[model samples]
Target: MKSIVAGLATEHAENGIGPVVLMLHGWGDSLHSFDALVQKLPGFRIVRLDMPGFGNTELPKDTWTVEQYAKFVAEFCKKTGVQPEYVIGHSFGGRVIIKAVSQRFLEPKKIVFIASAGVADRQNVHNMAFTAGAKIGKALLKPFPKSLYLRLRKELYRVTGGDYISAGALQETFLAVIKEDLSSDAAHIDRPALLVWGEDDIVTPVEEGKKIHRLIKGSELKVLSGAGHFVHQQKADEVAKLIQEFFI
Candidate 1:
C-alpha cells in the first residue's frame, strides 16, 4: 500500500519483524524488484520503498542530483519514524545510500550494494562519436515532422549505444546523477559493507564493485558468475543468504 511520507505518496512494504533493513532499488526499477530477496529475508524487518519517479511515488519537486535524492530519503525516514539498522541498495539507489551514509544522514550499522553505480562512469569514445553523429543528423533533419525526428533520434541512440530516454525532468536528473563521482564518499564510509556484483554485468561492471570494496574499510566483495546487472534478482536466494549472514 501507499503511505504519504513527507508529502510524497510512497509505495512500500514493511514486513517481518526485528532490526530494520531499508531496501532501495535501482533506476527505472521499483520496490517490487526486491520481492524475491525480501521473501527470503523474513528474519529482519524489510523496509522497501519505491523511490520517487520510478514507481507510485511522485517525481521530485525539481531536477535533482544524487545529494537531493539522499536528502529526500532522509526526510522520508524521519517522517516515517524509521532508523534503519541496515541498508541495501542497487545501481542508482546505491549511489544514494553511499551519499547518505558518508554525509552522516543515516547511520546504519551495515550496508550492501548490488551491482552498484556509485563510481563515476568512464567516458565512452564510441558514445561520444555517436553523439556527434546524432547532432549532425538532427541538424540535417530539422525540417522533418516531429514524429519522424523522434523516431530517428531513438534509432540513433539504439545504434550508437547512447543512453537516451524521453526528454523530461527525470532524464535531466539522471544526467546530473551519473556525472557525480562518489569515490571520496566511499572512502569516508567506515561501516562494514558488502559489495556484491555480477561478473557478467556490463552496466555498472564488476570493476566498480572492486573499487568500492577497496575504498570502504573492512568491506567484503563477492562476485557471482553468470549473473548480470540485476544480480540480486537473478540469484535472490543466495543474495538473501549473504545479506542475512552479514547483518546477523
Candidate 2:
C-alpha cells in the first residue's frame, strides 16, 4: 500500500490478522528485506514500510537525523491508523525504535531488536580515523583533475569499508545518523524488550546488543548460533518462532 505520510509518498505492506507488529528495516534496505521473516510470522498482522530515502518511498528533501526518522515512524502509524502492539526493528531500524520509544512517539507493548546498530562510541573511533585519513587524502589530491579526484575519493571509501560511498544521495544523512550514540535513549526505554543478535555479527555485533540489553531494564538477549548479521533472514524459522513465543 502507498500513502502520503508527513508529505512523503510512502510504500508499505501489511499481512496476516492478529496483533499489529510493525517491522522496520535497516539502512540500504527496503521493506522487502523482511519478506522471508514476514512470511514465517503468520500469526500477527505484520506491517513493514520502505522508510524515507529507501525502497520506493520518496526521500526527504533535506538530510535526516535518526530523530527525524523516528518522528516519521510515528507519523506513519498515525496516518495508517496502526497501533502496533509489538514493534520489530533490524539494524538501523533498531536505532530508530530506541529513540521513538524513549521519546514516547510510539507506545508499543514490546520491542524486538534484531542485530541493531546504535552503539556509536565504539564505531566512532574507527570512523574518526577514516575521516582523518580521507581529509588528508583529499588535501593531497586537491590539485588533481576533478574526475580523478572524485574517483580516488570513491576508491578510498571503498577500501576503508565506508558505507558513505554506497549512501549515494543519503550520504549526509548517513553521517548524521551514525554520529549519534543511543545508549542514553536505550536506557530510557522502559518497555519489555527482546534483543536477538547473530553470534557472529560484525556489522552491529553481539556486543552492541549486549550493551542495549543492559541499558534497557528487563530486556532479554538471545544470541543465535552459526548466524551472522541479518540473522532474521538467515535463520527465519528460528527467528519467527522466537517472535511468536515472545508475543504470546
Candidate 3:
C-alpha cells in the first residue's frame, strides 16, 4: 500500500503473470468496493484507482465528466506503467472505460462492464433534470426564500430521484455526464469482453446488457439471478471466478 496526492492505492500481484488488471469503481463509490475480489485474484496484478472526488482522492474543483475521468485514468496508467491487460468498470466507470477503449487510450486484452451506462437503450432511472433543480434550490435558499426553495427541492428530487450532485461548483466540481451512444465504438474494440448483468438491475436493466452483448461482436454475457445493479458486489466471488477464467 502506498499514497499518492490523488488518493491511496493498494497493489496486489500474482506470482507470475504478464498482464495487469485495473479496476474502476462506479459513481459515488470508491476503490474499496472491490477489495474482496482483489484479494481473491492472486494470478493477475490488480490496481484500483480511487477516482478523484471520491474515495481517498479529494474532490476536485473541476467537475468530472466521463471523458475527463477517463483521461485521468489513462494518464495515471501511463505514469504507473500499469498497462491494464483487463479492465472492469462498474456503472459510471463503465462509461469511462468505453471512452478509453474507443479513443485508443488503453488497449487492454479484455474489458468488463458491470451494469454500465452510455448506451441509448439504457433506461436512465436518474432523470438528470432534477440535478439542475437541486442546484437551483440550494442557491436560491439564502434570503428567506423557504417556500420557493422547498418547492424546487421537491421538484428536483422527483426528477433526479435524489441528490447525486451537490450545488456549489457548477460544471467545475460536479456535473451530470452527457449521454453518448457508444454502440458503434464498442463494436470496433474487437477485444474480448465479459458483460455481467443482474436480472433485477433497475439502473441498467438486463435488456441493455443483452444489447451490449449483441453490439460488441463475439462478446460473452452472463446474467445473475436476483442480483441488482451491483451484481458484482452481491456475487463478487462468482464474478471474480468468471474474470479469472477469461484472463487466464
* Deviation (Å) of 7 in candidate 3: 11
Which of the numbered candidates is closest to the native, going by highest lDDT? 2
Report every candidate's CA lDDT.
Answer: 0.84, 0.91, 0.72
Q: Report the lDDT tens digits of candidate 3 across residue range 55-170.
A: 66655545566677777788788767778889999887887888889888888988998888767463333334444555676676646567876676566554564324343333
After TM-score superposition, what is the CA distance of residue 169 in candidate 1 from its true location, in Å? Answer: 5.3
RMSD to true structure for each model, in Å:
2.6, 1.4, 4.0
Point out the higher-scoring one by TM-score: 2 or 3. 2
Stretches of candidate 2 above 4 Å error? Answer: 135-140
Output candidate 2 Cα RMSD.
1.4
lDDT of 2 by residue, 1-248 (tens): 79999999999999999999999999999998889998898878999999999999999889899999999999999999999999999999999999999999999999999999997567678766666666788798889899998988888888875678888899889878887888899999998999999999989888898899889999999999999999998999999898888988
Comparing 1 and 2 on lDDT, the stronger one: 2
Model 1 residue runs over 4 Å out of place are 120-145, 160-163, 166-169
In angstroms, the error of model 3 at 184 is 3.7
Clash totals for all candidate models: 0, 0, 4
* Ranking 1 against 3 by TM-score, winner: 1
What local lDDT does model 2 show for residue 52? 95
